[model samples]
Target: MKVYISGLYSGTSPQPGIGLSRSLRIAYPDATLVGVEYSNRSSGIHWLGFDELWLQRPWEELDLPAYGQLITELLDGGALWISGTDLEALWLASVFPDGHANLLSPPAVGLSRITKPGVEAHKGLPLQIPPFVSTDHSDWDLHAFCRKHDWRVWLKGPYYEAVRTKSWDQFEAVRSALAKVWSTQRLFLQAHVSGYEESVMLAAYKGELLGCVSMRKRELTEDGKTWAGDVTEVPEAFAASLREIIRDINWSGGAELEMIKDPEGQRWLLEWNPRFPAWVHGATIAGCNLPAMLVEAATGIPAEKTTAQSEEFTRVVLEVPVRARYPLPPLPEPYAG
Candidate 1:
């Protein structure tokens, strides 16, 4: 089976993408893997043993019609496209002509909920979320919101993007920052969740959960920006809940769900990502090679769950790379065709 990985960029030193690719190759030595870099500069790292590498200008600069045609050709040639970047995954879900099955529907309704107030006043139904008020600007009356919720509330975006603040003052700070961001881009805010954060990453075939691995969050950024944690074997109940959620969504391909353990130690659904996590390499170390399983899913083969090698597990620690930020090129007009 041929697997095509998109959004491979050069200049990412200590190379996260290459490290992921190398791990995948180690798991499935005979499989064909191709790297598609969006930049002209080559890594020069001999991919060890891989099928091919294609470097081109960023996809945003390409003509949509031609790019779609090219992608269709590649898919026709039996390549399953897996995205390593969030924007790329969103773009693929939005722009792909085939409307290939995605794990979660784009956050249209979720975004709407964040903007409109009093929407989430009603409790969420079993699996459906209640509507809530939202603002593009965070300058709303925090005192009023806190008073209404008895000083306990969550701040999140329409589609479940969230940040927790212990006090109204801190919440206001987050709101101000979000307001500035929303002025330039779409944003949402939701109530803070008080619970343990757990994530389940799975390989699925047309909504059927084939294999999954779950982990609990150990450390998180103050604003919940990045996840840093150790891997624990998923509890049976949590794994079942995740499988049920995926089945309900009728997801296809790769998907991940983040759940929170409430004060009562009950898990509540948090947010859903229909693609691999940034720290998914941790799973590869645990013996669940996601990239390869994705390859298998793409090729119509069922992937068997492999036992996680607890002894071989490695903890991933991320440090900000020192680099000068260059001015990015002018933004292209939104894709209109």
Candidate 2:
């Protein structure tokens, strides 16, 4: 099948798109692969061994019409389009609302449903949701909310994006920083949840779970603080419970479940990421290549059999690499020729 992979950039290496491309080449040696780069730097070309490569200016600068037209062109030619970047996926979901039919259903449904609130209101279910009070000001009550929750709560964006804080003063400081860029009224608050974090990455088709892997966080960082951690497979019972949850939600494509372990040793739902997780590279190394699985799901091919072995004691580190660029000294002022 013809597959198109888009969203390439110079700083995209920390993501698993390139690694996914390499894995796809190994798995489907004969299938045609197309790579599209969205930047002028063109660093992705060196890694994505594709049958064809297309480079365009970054998406932000492109006119909506041009961007839509380009996407249509690519879709018209390829049987499957794997968005190698989150922005591309969001763009597709917005511009070509029905275009995701080419993909499996779960992820598409999750994206469409969770992008906005009020569709489903919290009914006070026993789910581990942090108590939140909304205010007109994006920065309103952030400190009070944390204080009410005993100096710990999660600061959430309109969506599930979370920022954890330990004190009302710290929470207020975060709100101040965000207020510089975003209106405080746009910010919301949630009670902070304290527990071990675990994630389940899975592929589903027609509400049936096809493949899944559970991982515990080996490390976590927020606000410049980092903690070391490890990932292990979810026990069979927990996996089954999470699968049922996915099925109940009528989820269809690629998705993940974030959970926390309470002091009682029970798993509590943390949040659901309708798309790929940030640490997808870890899943790739653990024998589940999410991008390839997504491609297979899009094309109606069964996901490759994944070994159910956990790389226990396997330590992984997420590091930010910084590089300094030196500029050339300006040439001598023009000498009269």
Candidate 3:
């Protein structure tokens, strides 16, 4: 069987594609693993392990119909897709509104309710989502928010990335940068809760929680992404919440629930990422290979009760030679010569 994994970029700010591919390779040794990337320059393309690599046009260049057509073409012959980026996963959910058997992603209807802002307003989930205000709100005040949170708040995009700002100046600079890069002024502010950062990686299928692993960040990068972490016991309350969330949304495929456990021992729900975390390979190394479990669920293989066996896992940078088969990004006209 052929499996396609997207979002293969790996850099200082990494994507999950390389890690997910690694996990899948370990589980399905003989399966044809295809690394699908939108940009030609995605470094992971040359990192090895894939049986085949495909480069497509960037997402910005594709409209809805074109995107749908591309997906249909890619899924020909019933290839299973595991998207490694939130944007692609979200769009894939929409493309398969009624749900396609081969697509491993959350349902489209549920996606709307789990966006960064939507999660804060969602009810019946037994978790405290930090209070936030959208920049688009008529009465939005960053200064007031900063003062309330002791000048320590997380400036977040509606869909991706969060910057912890301890002052208004920092907030303004990051906000400006995000606005320019994302081409939108809409963003949100979440109150910063001082605590230990943790994530619960789960594999679910149509409301059933298949397997899960809990991790506490032992190390973090400048952007707050997991660099190293330790396997921890999954809290019963957290598991119950995951069940409720999965049932409420009929969630399918892989998900990461980020939370901050404050000094008082209360877990504050940060956000629910629709796809697996970049550190997913860490979970695989720890013995709970979620990407493989997702494949098993989709392929009718009996589920395995996988758990983390290794206590901890850490990341290190690797430099590899790019194969000549992969195309490089085009240079500017003046530099082309």
TM-scores of all models?
0.65, 0.69, 0.88
> Which parts of model 1 have CA positions greater than 4 angstroms off?
7-23, 37-52, 56-60, 97-132, 136-143, 146-186, 219-228, 237-241, 300-307, 311-337
Question: lDDT: which candidate is best?
Answer: 3
Report the Cα lDDT for residue 330, model 2. 49
Number of the candidate with higher TM-score, 1 or 3: 3
Which candidate leads the pack in TM-score?
A: 3
After TM-score superposition, the amount by which residue 304's alpha carbon in candidate 3 deviates from its true location, in angstroms, is: 9.4
State the lDDT of candidate 2 residue by residue for 1-337, as single tens digits: 7676664443423333454565566556677777767654545555536667666666767787877776677566655666656556655656665444454333444465543222231122233543565534444454556567886666655544466768667766766665553444566666655677777777665556666777777655543211333455656875676567566555555656666777776656655555555455456566666666666755766545544344643323334222122123347898798
Residue-level lDDT tens digits of model 3 in 62-174? 57688687677766668888888988887788788756777888878668777886583246545678888887754347688778888777889877788888877788899
Alpha-carbon RMSD, candidate 2: 6.4
Q: Candidate 1's residue-wise lDDT over 180-295, tens digit each?
A: 64443344444545767777776665556667777677766555533455665666765677567545555455556666767776555556555666556667767777656655
lDDT of 1 at 65: 69
Model 3 ranges off by over 4 Å:
118-126, 138-140, 166-170, 176-185, 302-309, 327-337
